[model samples]
Target chain A: MKKFLNDPVNFVDEMLEGIYAAHPMVTYVNDDLRCLVTAKPKAGKVGLTTGGGSGHLPTFLGFVGDGMLDGAAVGGVFQSPSAEQMYQVTKAVDQGVGVLYIYGNYSGDIINFDMAAELADLDGIAVKQVVGNDDVASSIVGEEHKRRGVAGIFFIYKAAGAAAAEGLSLDEVARIADKARMKTRTMGVALSSCVVPEIGHATFSIGEDEMEIGMGIHGEPGISRKKLGAADAVVDEMMERIFNETDYKSGDDVAVLINGLGGTPLEELYILFRRVRQLLDARGVNLKHVWIGEFATSMEMAGASISILHLDEELDRLMAAPANTPFFKHVTG
Target chain B: MKKFLNDPVNFVDEMLEGIYAAHPMVTYVNDDLRCLVTAKPKAGKVGLTTGGGSGHLPTFLGFVGDGMLDGAAVGGVFQSPSAEQMYQVTKAVDQGVGVLYIYGNYSGDIINFDMAAELADLDGIAVKQVVGNDDVASSIVGEEHKRRGVAGIFFIYKAAGAAAAEGLSLDEVARIADKARMKTRTMGVALSSCVVPEIGHATFSIGEDEMEIGMGIHGEPGISRKKLGAADAVVDEMMERIFNETDYKSGDDVAVLINGLGGTPLEELYILFRRVRQLLDARGVNLKHVWIGEFATSMEMAGASISILHLDEELDRLMAAPANTPFFKHVTG
Candidate 1:
């Protein structure tokens, strides 16, 4: 494999060490390398935390800073962090207020975070969670709760973090987070697969002229493989799936995120966004905000995902609130 | 070539249209799609403008915002913009305090920007220019002026933009920008070649087991092609060359930027940064700041570059000054 790495087994630890060295705002919790917390925690506010595998950057770690996440429990690439690591990060960021765990809806993450919350409860710390379930391709209708989370988790983090920063209680914060998750939807298409460092090979492969529609972040089997089509056609297919899955309609306010799957360049992401905007305008969807970049990604996977969040008044206010993080920063109302 | 694009000929215009649509802070100058300017300009300050080819996302267009470049003239993918585009951007951004043109040192860009300056002069708008030459592999020691510009252009942009935001005169801003350029040095290694959309093929090719050190952004030949080595060894060779070509001393304070060439993962970039920090620490160099991401990039090239800038007090202050752009946002100092 052509990669800049020392040893495959030590990639995660060394990467975390490098991140700690590069960002002053990020620090280890209780000397545990897997648990990264903000250097300065805001007191009397609900502590927001998230964690997942290492490949998707600007997801858990990059969101740890003022107005976003308080702590993050990072795992090895494509693996889950231990319950012990999550407990420690919870303890590190919790002030007088409680801690809430937010992460993608994966079996390993759900199990570990539930164990950590149980452990934290014994230590006299209140804990709650809202698992993200935004991927429409993972399940059929009436099975949205069983769907996997994808790039739409970013919207949940922003809205829930804004609510927490407003000094909401842990229960209220969890409610807002769940509401956001219920409204968000995402779908992705991949032209290539990503290689995990330890594996030293691509997780999967596809024909050069074919593309996988509705693929999950971890190379999960998608709807089908088909001959590669034009950008607009692919976008139209993805958008139709999303619209059918969600209750969004004309004259509704929404937020849009065009996320790149690591290997795609910004030029292509923007090109994809152009078609997305054109479709939304024709449908009379009022776009409140648009974000186009690599917000979450599989390591060096060539693909893109579209996420749309139907915003209510409360969700709109929370989404528009100020946020300052290493990867995301906005000073909108 | 596997890419998400429509007609390759219309890629640049579509990408720019998407960027304009995504960023509310940006708008076209006089309905000209080639010239992108900030919606809100700070008057009586030196108007900072930078432009280049379309592939580098955050370089020329993403930096047009508060406390950064006032405007950007965009070109086709991997192609220099025209003099007419630069002249229009110059006219649009020029307040009473004149305009400063900052871009990479390339033959087409130099000729076009020079022509734009002449055109602006006839229109009674003062224009001064500073070209960046920081790539250590493009030229020998005495021919530093002939070196190609690379990721180190970001440092020049930050320093010069901060100086211009401080209301410095045209000459003062140019001087600071030039000083920053002189103190900066960069070297890169490419694992794979980028594909130009119009050509629908790789710009160049290399053996799977080989890497080109000190390669130009557009696939210009590098210093050597050798079997790919460990991250530490590659970094050591790059650092040794940079140290030998410059006058950086043991007690120097510097800012380091580890920039990805579009396709490398952040995990690998951090792995590379870990080795870079170790080398600088052993040399007694104090790192004041570290930036690790895709600051400047070829379309989807698989590689990375390291840039180091030895800073004096003025340059340090300028580098730390607050700036808010679409891709970069820091509230330091």
Candidate 2:
């Protein structure tokens, strides 16, 4: 478990310092809070805030920019940002229009961010909360609504970012983010586990020749552990489950994301997306857009996840909107 | 040397197939050639083209989007795209506004891409070429103009893509891309060598306690190899050389990119970037913008690089422009 750090405890602090040093256009609320605010806040646009555990480079923080998130509350590695931290970020990033609290659905994250949102409201800040529950692997067959949030949170970011970039109000931003979340579903698998730098050990274990099906981003055990299989088969199982959980139909336009869970190769993700595309094509699903790479990561775990979103005209337009942050940008069109 | 592939020979083909399946909006020129074109190519906009080996995922392919590149010509893993392949891509992507050829500088890449540009011009398709030579490690101190191109090519894509997206003519886009090359410089080090899937072995050699400085992205050995040192010390040596070789001044505004070669963790890139910022700040250098991640990968090697660019007003505007590709997007005001 070799790493490039002097002390494990200094990891987050040093990382944030470097991020700030590299990007002088962003402001840090405080060391204790671990909140980042835009250097130049938009006067009337709804402020967007998101945060979670660290290690998923570019997920919450990477998406911060003009159109994405105005602020991000960062926690420890694979740990939730504190309630106080989220509150500070909300206040710092908020404009007269208000702020949107978008985040994943982990128990710790939900409790903390929920508390932050309440606190913001008491402080005379209009803050709306939206929890992304798009992970099909975290729910039972009949409990799709209970799914946890995973990489699918990226779509929420895109939607919220686009809306806010368009100068939407807090209500409009929340609505678009929630709508994007409803249309999105994701599932991940881990072929190998990762070592947390702070802990200096593997978070979980997997046999060299075996893989865990529907693994969570933090290396949490999935519904089943199975032998590593062919790319097509893996994609089929993952996409089929996601497809079954979502109300996708033939001729329905959608955007697909094949994400590397930190350590997986782009080669593998592309392969997974290929199989996913084939399956969708067989079902007569119309694929309108696709993204493949490490959008959301979990340390250095060799795994990948698939996210499918049935798109509407609004979502599609938002998808094409411009965004610029340290780790992401969507300005092509 | 573990990899996920059925056969070595099928690596590139399968990867291409998988990309096509994932994004229906992207279609390749030929079933055999890895020249990916946008599903909807805009008319009257100067077409942008970039291509390189497969290992640098998102570099050549991940960048094909509306404001970015129109098409990408992919070669084998760490191999150069053939002249004919580039020629085919130019023809397929050209919208009657001419084509801009932007690629990295390596012997094979230069030869092949140059040949392609010549062919395109001979066919009466206005073609412009700009070779990226930004790797400060490969150049002599007194002759900085002879530097090689490494991971800094990603910036080239963004700047050029933004210009083309704004409907810049081929000549103007070429000039901007060339200016970006002049402003950029990169230097990389390897803690571990990368293994090409097809070779089933590493492309270079490194001991458990050794490191290579000034290595090429193809796993080629660096100019020197020595015992590994602390992150700060290692970065200091790299940055001093890079800074000394360029026109960057203490108060000059610059863009910093700390790119992981492939297998290194984001945690490490942070540590390295921390030291890098400190060194730059101590010298009175101002970092206007920064990006740290696996933007340009080289298989799954455990290494990283530092890229610095002196941003002029035009370069800054171009750098701040929006880009929409699979891996990167930047929408700006």
Docking class of 2: acceptable
**What overall lDDT goes with each candidate model?**
0.89, 0.81
**What DockQ does each listed candidate score?**
0.77, 0.42
Here, model 1's chain A TM-score works out at: 0.98
Per-residue lDDT, model 1, residue B203, is 93
Please, what are the lDDT tens digits per residue for candidate 1 over residues A183-231? 9999999999999988989899899888999999999999989988888
Measured by TM-score, the strongest candidate is 1
List TM-scores of chain B, every candidate: 0.98, 0.95
Once fitted onto the true fold, the runs of candidate 1 whose alpha carbons sit more than 4 angstroms away are none
Residue A73 of model 1, lDDT score: 94
Question: Model 1, DockQ value?
Answer: 0.77
Worst 10 residues of 2 chain B by lDDT: B324-333
Residue A24 error for model 1, in Å?
1.3
